[model samples]
Target: MVSGSGVFVFDSSGKDYIDAVSALFCATLGFHNERLIEAATRQMRELPVYPTALNRTVPVVHALADALSAAAPIPDAHVLFATTGSEAIETLIKTTWYINKQRNPKRHKIITRRGSYHGSTIFATRLGGIESIINSFDLTGDDILYAAQPRWPRDALAGETEEDYAHRLALELAELIDHTGAENIAAFLCEPVSIAGGMYPAPKGYFEAIRNVLSMRDIPLYFDEIVTGFGRTGKMWGSQTVNQT
Candidate 1:
């Protein structure tokens, strides 16, 4: 209701439905904001076919980069634009493997959670921890290790506290790392909150504990902020809300 645009209808039927998911939850700004519509119109009118690989530049791209940089925690966090979240994830996963290969070829595996969802691409689907995704494609990616998901509501024992549950999850992750031999793992990737895995928020101290383990093992933590970015979790970033450093 922030911008308040009425839902679209294709026929004369008066029945209308709420867009509960908001176009795969990407339309956080809601439908048809004047600014967004105007921006798209302007971009389409201007030079728009420049590909980044061709080293071509566009004013809108530069402007977006500047704005993102101004709001980013890292002043120089380079932004790689993609048409969708899946493409962005694909870029990151491949980039991670390439960079690790350059530094240490043995460190090729990426660790993720058992119930997480990255994207629908073959590699990303394999990287994700959802059983249905893996089972549907007969994916047996040995490089990625699936750690136990930190589901406080479901995984926590009857008498267990949130802090205790987080610690247990951390311990289990540490054990997995030890079993997998951290030297062979390039990075551990996850969203700050489990979104596609049912929107379950992480238990308290989960990120800090996991971060410490990754730090000790020299594994880079990739916070997939595609869903939780732009203050969706009542903060600028979910990592900041969870105190992940």
Candidate 2:
């Protein structure tokens, strides 16, 4: 597409199509938004560029961080900003890696659901659950594990209730953990609603069951809220929608 307006983008041939993907799901706000344009103009006129380095940050950075932390569901929340979703996810992965290194070096593996996506950065790409992307790019990693996605009807049993299916998945996860040795696992990462592979919301009690399994082994759970943050799911965070902690 050459350009976009509202939810539609125009091609070179003058044909307009609805931008259903939202530019890799990053630009939540539609194009040609006057408020966003004005905000960008105002910020640029004052301070064109600034980087948040060691003990140094611009006023806008602090203000935006404060606003994000204030709205976050995490208690005593702090904000970490990145230029792209990929960078943010990469940051999170590194943080977990660092934590595991300090706590237990053996616990370095991260388990993610099949078809789920964290980002496209080196480690983030390895964390993704899309098989095609992984195989095509040769992005396989020994420390990353893939589990089945909670795709509802497609994977559900003939008469399995949503809760039952979720429990079954949890059991499967527990088995995987046991086989791999829970002591060697670092974290469990996933998107609350799968986006990269396809949009699919987990069945109710999904996180609850997953938590039950993870808690028994004291595994940390993390979610990639790239597309579901800032009121995207009618809430400030997708964790709220999924009742995940």
Taking all chains together, each candidate's TM-score versus the true structure is 0.90, 0.91
Model 1 segments more than 4 A misplaced: 1-12, 15-20
Q: Model 2, residue 124: what's the lDDT?
A: 76
What C-alpha lDDT, on a 0 to 100 scale, does residue 15 get in candidate 1? 49
lDDT at 120, model 2: 79
lDDT tens per residue, model 1, 106-126 = 898888888788888888888
What are the lDDT scores of the predictions, listed in order? 0.81, 0.86
Candidate 2, position 207, lDDT: 91
Error of 1 at 191 (Å): 1.0
